[model samples]
Target: MNDLEDLPEKNKIFESDIFIKILTSPREAFKFINDYNYEKHLYILLFLAGMLRSFDRASTKNMGDNYSIWAIILISIIFGGLFGWITYYIYSALISWSGSWLNGKGNTESILRILAYALFPSILSLIILIPQIAIYGETMFKSENDFYSSGLVESVIYYGFFIIELILGIWSFVLCVIGISEVQKLSIGKSILNLLLPAILLIFFILILVLLFKLIN
Candidate 1:
């Protein structure tokens, strides 16, 4: 009972003290994550990601009015949770399997949790949406053409957000590499290999399937 009551405070400490380190000092962050296995906030992170995803999708398609804010959030959480679970499991599984061949060391469960931590950068990326909503306003939610057809200042804001997203995406990938490497007991190079191997295999597999289909035709 006491521990449950204390979980929120403890989580606050973890978020403040540890989560920020993920960007500045990822090796230490991964060490802490591996040692403590802080898993409580994963869902919260996923929920935030969901909200961002929902908002982005709505804005991109200009379907903002199609769903109420609460409805959009709720729907996003459901779909995001489903997709997050599947992607996390698949990515973790690949890391566990191929990562081992690269001399990486980590279990599926731990990798999954670590991968959730990697999403912190993505959450930060959501900051872009604020100005996006302000600058584009109803146009973002009403019509795709209107969203893209921006004035000079609006064009600058749009491209600025795009650049921020790109940087954030790269930051997230780097954090994932560092976190995965630390947990898996792999060197950075090998850790990257661990991460990329599955992707390469998938691409190769798709190419083979395409070739076979063409032959069959």
Candidate 2:
């Protein structure tokens, strides 16, 4: 009989120690995921990614005059989690479907696992955001607040956090590309194409729709 330690990595999913691995050695992490079908934290990761995305949109677009900061945060977490869950599945499906055109091997489930793990850095950005919200309050999300004019020190801190968050976001994308490459069994170039093809096709479809609408009008 085989002992627990003698089992293959797939059978030892509970012992994988993937969270730290996903950040430090993403290629190996992705390889384990592809091999083991690791998906224990999928929902929470998707929810957090959604929340971060919602907060980003709120910062840029503002939440109108009626919402309080607490309300905004609450709404962002709940709705963003739902949106993230839905979009994660949609994106995985799109990537899988599109990648097949390049003779790629990954399916939607594998793509979903890759992306869920890839979101670790972006999720860490939430740690950076906590202090920004505490320091700036609603001004962080408001366009009329003249945020930078608060003080030189304040501006420096805000911008510093922003840069850190930006780096984490960029690193998240890097991880995604690396994870996709492993899952799809493709070169980095093809993995990038697999990732971008969905967006490119979506933009093209939208343009065609707009052209058709103009002609009809």
Q: Model 2, residue 199: what's the lDDT?
A: 98
Per-model lDDT = 0.74, 0.85
| Alpha-carbon deviation at 167 in model 2, angstroms | 0.7
Provide TM-scores for the models. 0.76, 0.91
| For every candidate, C-alpha RMSD to the true structure in Å | 4.9, 3.0
Q: Could you tell me the TM-score of candidate 2?
A: 0.91
In candidate 2, position 92 carries an lDDT of 94
lDDT of 2 by residue, 103-214 (tens): 8899999899899889899899999888888887877777787755778987899789989988988999999999999988889999999999999999999999999999
Question: Any runs in candidate 1 off by more than 4 Å, and if so which?
Answer: 1-16, 50-75, 137-149
Q: Model 1, 144-194: lDDT tens per residue?
A: 444366688777777878888888878888988888888899888888888
